[model samples]
Target chain A: MSIRYPNGKKFEKKRIFSGQKNVNNKDDRFSNRGMSLEEDINETNDYYRAHQIAVIHKKPTPLQIVKVNYPKRSAAVVTEAYFKKPSTTDYNGVFQGKYIDFEAKETRNKTSFPLKNFHEHQIQHMKEVMQHNGIAFALLKFSLLDEVYLLEAHELMSFYDKQDTNRKSIPKKEIEERGHLIPFGYHPRIDYLKIIDKMIDRC
Target chain B: MSIRYPNGKKFEKKRIFSGQKNVNNKDDRFSNRGMSLEEDINETNDYYRAHQIAVIHKKPTPLQIVKVNYPKRSAAVVTEAYFKKPSTTDYNGVFQGKYIDFEAKETRNKTSFPLKNFHEHQIQHMKEVMQHNGIAFALLKFSLLDEVYLLEAHELMSFYDKQDTNRKSIPKKEIEERGHLIPFGYHPRIDYLKIIDKMIDRC
Candidate 1:
């Protein structure tokens, strides 16, 4: 079946479900199959943090807390709050003494990942990260194909700078050609650190 | 004058204003010192992070988000949320390839810093940090005196373990002698990297 976003971008639902099912069973969408990419990455990060392999976490969205209610004998309840502008990338941490920063996004697109997926602030943050010698990248999940790719910030910046005239999206063929493919596994399902190791080596 | 918290902790107003404040000159309150110690440390960590010096940030209080509202043209608003069990310290990041973890607290007591200021779960988290070869500490601020100290997790653990019979607080003299004094300065106001440097040297 086909699924299209509000922005008129077409997506194939088949790509979103491909290898998502458990390899040990026939039911891919069953409860036993697996968790989402975000969950897998969170779990992998937890493992990495525990083992001291690397320290990384998803940065919480900045919020402007306005009103808080303190009950008689309970925790404070935030009655009113608002979203604040995020000054940096969505995720950042240290890896093997190197600064790591990135954003994670998943799409069901079988053809390309749209440039509109990223914001101008995120691009600016990436540029800042690069200026400070930080390793910045994006974890792009082609959910339909159940594949993930780590595209370096430098490449993303290049695309962003030329996005005005070039294609509004990064083609899957180009992603395969330029980005590091992250293989899924049982333990540390995303195994992003392996790609991180490669990135470190390149650096 | 004195201020009382719901917990019945009495806080004495330390600074006495002599004259009416000018438009440009503002009084520095405990909250307005341009980000709490937690924030200054986080900024230092960011600086460290960008410079590959350290990775650290204040851990968000774990909240079980129960309800979210998606407005037609706005960001998602969390309407209902509850605090969840936090598994780690308030702040943690990587430094010089070492996992750095810490909790921060402010006290008004001029004689001693109370043991009750820290939660049991926080103590447990510190223990876990130690088990993982992480450098853990607490940044204690005597707000009235504008003094901050970096007390190691081991010392805190030792104090906590002896809470049954020993004094309920660690005397300021003890902290002065044992804990590293973090001198306040410009740029990174509460320049904690200097303390971290000393701690790193000790390690």
Candidate 2:
């Protein structure tokens, strides 16, 4: 399961730890101890898939490979490649006969979530998703606060635009007021579909 | 850009040449001279995107890297990686508020498409997509015959299942009769969405 780099260095799984000191220590049914936000979302996706509730999946990281080595009677080996920025959001799939797409990110900052975390291409992609009548949103996890919120793409886009003239980050209060709080659950740790249900109801 | 393999050999694009010798020579608006089926489909997807029709994209080839070299003032380079079989279909995205997922393959056989072109994991993935109420199908292109068909996942799954005891190939006659013929157009070369529209109408 462990991967090594060309330089003989092992690949490190980047973990964004929370800044809070007094977070709950008890592991809830939904909690997997020491799991990162990305790991939690992946587990939730698997849960949804196993139950036949949805078919969402995180797109594989894009890579631009320049050179490869094909040994006779063996698998091809990539010798040179660089990571590429994704053109769309992380997660997308079908739920209740609807097109669902969203990006999930975690921030350790307690006061505000930095807008710089998202790229312009990703923002443009969400806008396109919304224009096509597909449900688009962001799963913003305030790791320090132990809180997750589902913010609509429109809200995120608006804040992103304001960064050019106004504040560069989305204040915690704005997110709390505008975003739908997603309650963690046992089987599906981050029950995002629950928030999606409400959004669908409103529509 | 050209790529080189580890054995000092240049990577060549695998093309399935047509089996028939009497194919048409006239340049049709739908036809992009010397382009492979994959290239044409990519162009069609781009056409769809420009027209606000859909946002489908082919997932990048999955690679499991074991080595990389990170140097200062440059992006990290992957030194050793192996290809992995994808767990889902190639092209997937939202189309007209519906979740769309599909696999596209080109064949050189004049009689029937060899079932060996598809893998069991792919069949299972399509079944999962169907279970989630997503639109799942296969774009089968007979390169020699210069014909393309939009075959439903159910049709493919049934034929795939029969391969265990029945014929290993799906006869061309069976495919033509059961699958919808996708008309080629100037802008969006393979207009498979027309077939999807008919399918939706039937539903």
Candidate 3:
């Protein structure tokens, strides 16, 4: 629901390319085919819904609307609104009869995923979900490496708790040991649910 | 999340009383209390969260932003936006290890509840949730009578399916026969999880 990726260089690059139009070369146009992590996961959810596999949705970004103007013969227009920090994770829904909640984030850093990518409230939200028997996890993407990992909420929170000390991030080796690598596929793109299936089986 | 109750009189009444300033009598101020069904449900969800009962959230109203402007060193302002119809129900969450999804609606009609309170997609959403073994229902309120009922999604869809030819509304008598009454309380206001607990037991 909330896009808190901030103005990293990768975000800037995507924003810059968003306005590029009329480039008609077939292969050249196809070369920019892949989307951001959020878009890919959205499409994955869409695929799941269409195939009757799962029904998940990304919540809309919350906005503190200050003012709205209803123009004559037209729809209401939001004249002044500020983006509000979301109280919960961005995406949540029913999957395999279970409530699944997770936050997705991508970092361009090669060796570590910074704890700064997450807010304290989000970790606490995840903890609540886990406590209530809901599936909670983080979909961490290494943008440059094109790698994704599903870190269980408890593991992520454990690493986050240690951020009070000098350790400010989860190292790639640690993540590799603790998290499940979500293999990329064509139809659903990133098949994270496969990891969840394994998790359920292990449980 | 989407407010589709078009020109509802109860809604109008609430809007008119929203800005009253100089009312000092404690009883008078307290008398003009009680909120919309959505607000009541939101407060109930907050209470649930605080008590570690459940983690439910009403999705935000989706908006299609056509234009945005960023002034120097200020947050981006939406210049033009339109409300988008939501794909799913207003409220969904995990309760007691099960995914629960429902739409809440209130009507003034004492005899019957109109089927048009719901959209085709919303009914379809509920159907999908039920197919996935998720708990799905409608929290229906008869505002003038001050009564509420939890109609299972199956019962609701059965009524909705008949709307194509005749019987565009569900009689309140039938609702009472098929739906569970949700008793209002002082703390959580509408204690929906009680009905859900019964549902789980029956299953």
Candidate 4:
């Protein structure tokens, strides 16, 4: 599936060409693909914030900053820091009086999105958001196909809970059947709020 | 004019010892003495967010990242960056359906809070907020007396506008007479919502 921006500009998937012959190219993973999913989501978030369409932002990675160096006549630099476990989803904010929360991920696999893409902490975070009556979802981008799908957290949780005995990955067809396809746009890029409106209407 | 925490803990005011001369002392003008005003306000905001009382946060300083190093197997590290000119106040969020925006500052001067403590961009930002029907204000702390006040942006603008011919600072006595004193509390620490409640009531 191909995605088109608001002005009819088509977004093509980026490919990596390497000279190394012995490199394992058959194994597909997000990190190995070189295109950062976080960066793209952040860009889309900035577009949303600038247009006042939404106020979502990625929470700063929690850090336990232990020591700082106060160099002579300069800004203090953090010298020693460690990452701390995050208690919430990566992105959250208010949009039109509704609390919105979501996590974004990309996968290079052509057939399925792996259940391992999410963590236990993130699952728990989404559960808490659901308990609080907040809208929670995940943006899954099939990088190779240039398609983005907004999958509700409830749907994801159902798949996650059966991961131990069932298939370790969710088929792409399942997502297409159950998830909302988010179209890219000019002003807000990923206009997820359109999907949000539908979800609220259904509720 | 002295203030104490809700638990009755006295805030310690930093003092310059007589005859202690050092180059670092010259740099103290820009540096926070101790328990930074920004840090304290952030803590207060944390309290607000956790309790669902409000959703305020300091905007991350916009940075023009110049150089980034991409290691073979590590996350990208920003090596050099500089702050961009911000077009809005440092802090903003929603409080009970009202958009709230504010800047925070601390002064050691006993008689007055210097107008120079504020930046031109901050003033412009507050003006824009007012134009959008947003509540704008400044949280000023007098470090010498451990007192904090919520001074409305309009009151600050009036003082700032007269600074060309009048004194360059707002007298402490005037602030005491006009500004809303923020009471500290065990849960919220700054308890700024009391002043916000009064503002909403007036509206």
Candidate 3 chain B, poorest ten consecutive residues by summed lDDT: B21-30
Q: Model 2: per-residue lDDT, tens digit, B1-203?
A: 98865663222112232211111112212223455566778889899889999888888777776776779999777888878878888888888888889998767677898777777788898998898788999998876678888899999998998786568889999999999888767889998887786777888
List of clashing residue pairs for candidate 1: A15-A144, A16-A143, A16-A144, A21-A28, B55-B93
The number of clashing residue pairs in model 3 is: 1
lDDT of 1 by residue, B76-194 (tens): 67666655555556675545545567887766567888787777877976776566566778888876677899899898888788877568888899899988888776656566667
Candidate 1 chain A: 10-residue stretch with minimal lDDT: A19-28
User: Where does model 4 exceed 4 Å of error?
Assistant: A1-102, A111-137, A151-178, A194-203, B1-103, B115-137, B151-179, B194-203
Cα lDDT over the full model 2:
0.78
Give candidate 3 misplaced runs (Cα > 4 Å).
Answer: A1-33, B1-33
Docking class of 3: acceptable
**What lDDT tens digits, residue by residue, belong to model 4 across residues B13-69?**
223212111222223332233554566677888887777776666655444444445
RMSD in angstroms, candidate 2?
7.5
Docking class of 4: incorrect
Q: What is the lDDT of candidate 4?
A: 0.67
In candidate 2, stretches whose alpha carbon ends up further than 4 angstroms from where it belongs are A1-33, B1-33
Candidate 1 Cα misplacement greater than 4 A, ranges: A1-34, A49-52, A94-99, A130-134, A198-203, B1-62, B71-76, B89-102, B119-136, B152-168, B197-203
lDDT string for model 1 (A90-179, tens) is 676656556677887766677888777787887877776676566778998876678889999898888778876668888899899999
A1-203: candidate 2 lDDT, tens digit per residue: 98875662222112233222111212211223455567778899999989988888877777787777769999778888888888988788889878899988777677899787787898989998998889999999876567889999999988998786467889999999999888777789899998888778988
TM-score of 3: 0.85
What's model 1's overall lDDT? 0.67
